[model samples]
Target: MSTHKPLGRFLTAGAVAVAMLATAACSGSTEPSSEVTELTVILANSTFTENLPALAETYKAETGITVNVEAYGNEQLNDTLKVKLNAQSDEFDIFGYQVQDVMREFVRNGWLTDISDYVNNSGDWDWNDFQESARDAVQLDGKVYGVPVATERHIMYYRADLLKEAGIAVPTTIDELEAAAKALHNPDKGFYGIAMRGARVPLVTQYSSFLYSYGGDFQDEAGNSTINSEAAVQAYNTYGRLLHNYGPPGATNMGWVEASAIFAQGNAAFYLDADSQAYTFLDPQKSAVVDQVAYARFPAGPAGSHPYNIVFQTLGINSFSQKKDAAFDFIKWVLNKDNAKLLLGEHTLPVARSSAWQDSSATEKFPAGLVEIVRDTDSNYVGHDRPQLEAVARAREFVGGPAVTAIEGGDEAAVKAAAEQANTEFQALLDTEKR
Candidate 1:
């Protein structure tokens, strides 16, 4: 969701082809033109989705069905799905969505066709290949609505050469993370300590790791608002201070893409972003510090490093589709081991398959310890990056305002006041949704 802004309209085929590799399957008059079935898929134009046309072409060649792929920006796709699916339009047979952000509304509106039977009845699909956390996220009222497409967690990406120059080891705790940033900071020399997401919306995902590590969250276990807790205040203060004091100029204007670019270009010593962003950093053509990049777990706080390990994207069949079976087939085809291997080869986000992560070919593709960090974090401490409430997108807007202000160097008093106001407003919105 943090790459380029999602265009509100369907993307062009050429645009999708940029990041995708398509292959034609063996076909010699297996089925006549009249017997072809066409299924449409709509998804966000991310690394995974952009490359999906390749799988679609393979599916088409296998079954003689024409698979049409349509992609929109993440937010735009969410809004488009909301509007189009609510009307029960059959324009798309299947779609992918941000699970935590949009599933609540999609489930409530009954726009998704439940695919539990497809999951439960298929053994070769190795339904168990998916991690439990990922499987659980796509379910609603104990029924599976979608198949998880992409899963990720926030991890630390640092300049190994810079750390060595500073005579420091990789940070393991919140205090060390701060020290590392402060020590490497040299504004006069045009280098920053850290490159962090600060734009209002995308900031929410980055802040979640800090918030959880400090033992604060959007709500308590009982679902009451905890945005104004003492831990909340401290977490906000620490995050704000790190960026305002040691971050690049105009830090508040940056999201993951901007911040990660700064890190990849060697302007910052450390960057906090999703693991998928590492692809750009590792690509020599896309980065200046490719060989200097290294990965680490999100630095631990007093509560330990509880990063958001979320199945961020999922594919589902539309309830209104006349081609639900074909849609499910397409979903299966895309996530199968061979296709996942292809995605891994492209250095995209690691998928939900444990076996995939353990594959030698997949492991050897990246920096030494990335797959290990991805594996450990995936199996250990991870949660939803955001709340799964009906009002989540709106909630992020209000709840995230204070962090944005703090990162912009607002005075302590003003930042605290903003948090207090956001707490009340956020609770009110959550309460409205509950009622």
Candidate 2:
């Protein structure tokens, strides 16, 4: 999935600048010798937002640093960070960045300071605690750029009860999967065989899983675009057929949120998505079919089994932040074993630390499936070829624009042509950015 979660427009550049100016002005005049130094943090607006204020209060009580937290949607925060960093302003002390693709530019430009020295020096913090892959995602050219807060792995979630009712077993192969979908599909009754993400980014992410199953990657290790290969064409065709024939009406408009909602609402026979959606799907308050859900590995493809893993949003200190030391300390304190346990207890995000995964208290609180997901990830995971910032942007634009046109316009020829165009543009982008 390229690790870049879509950042929605929630906060504007002007708004962030105004907010920072106000905070700086307030801090400058009133608090010259105050015991607490206010640290400004930019974070994603998710369920975790509720936990921050409480964590901040506790941190203040313990260490006496008053933390000022501002929440933005994922994309909004990235945009804000980009604007501030490009201007070389220390407006934000820390930013929550997910995709390494987005962070690559900052790392390459030396706009992000390496915190490896700080992490190594901390007596209480154990760098070995984090999962190797999750930790590796934040490392560039053998230096740590950020600390991961949580991780996610994708899996197949199905309704066991519905499958039994239909007298169909969980399909393990591509053909079997299609048969299962056909058996479960009931358009008149408002139930779909499967709920797939047909929307822009979600489509690209979900499509990649299928593409991988067919032994096709967006790029090989040598970083060449393979989108129009025979295997890729087959995978794309399969996706199109699934969406057109088995999915619900208006499926083209459904993103992760809508897809998850359809599955949780008891109308979907199977849903494949990131494991992070587990809590919401199982929550009785959120899901209508909470008790009917069952989890399994991704269905096998022509080549072999292929499932996608999504690591959690990473926490990075602004390279320009004056509070570099304090920021590193805060990161250590938050991601360390004890605090991670506490956070997992409240909200069941998979901690990046392997040691934290082994905690009995954590096992008692989080779902057993979470541990399984983590294990499966550690053992059998494949990552996208890390793309440069421009290449990654081109991929997003190409996939998003073409996939949307195909689904909404219902023109296969147009879709194929668009894909070709996108591939051409992607190659051009790579050529231009070649070092």
Per-prediction tally of clashes: 1, 1
TM-score of 1: 0.83
Q: What is the C-alpha lDDT of each candidate?
A: 0.77, 0.68
What is candidate 1's lDDT per residue for 339-394, written digit by digit as tens?
A: 56556645445788766777777667767668888667554455577755788878
lDDT of 2 by residue, 343-434 (tens): 55446657677776676666565556556656556534444322334457556666555556655644667667766776677666666666
Estimate candidate 2's alpha-carbon lDDT, on a 0 to 1 scale. Answer: 0.68
Which lDDT value does model 1 have at 226? 83
Cα deviation of 216 in candidate 2 (Å)? 2.9
lDDT of 1: 0.77
C-alpha RMSD in Å of predicted model 2 compared with the true structure: 8.9
Which regions in candidate 1 have their CA more than 4 angstroms from the true location?
1-38, 60-66, 73-76, 346-349, 408-416
Clashing pairs in 2: 7-75
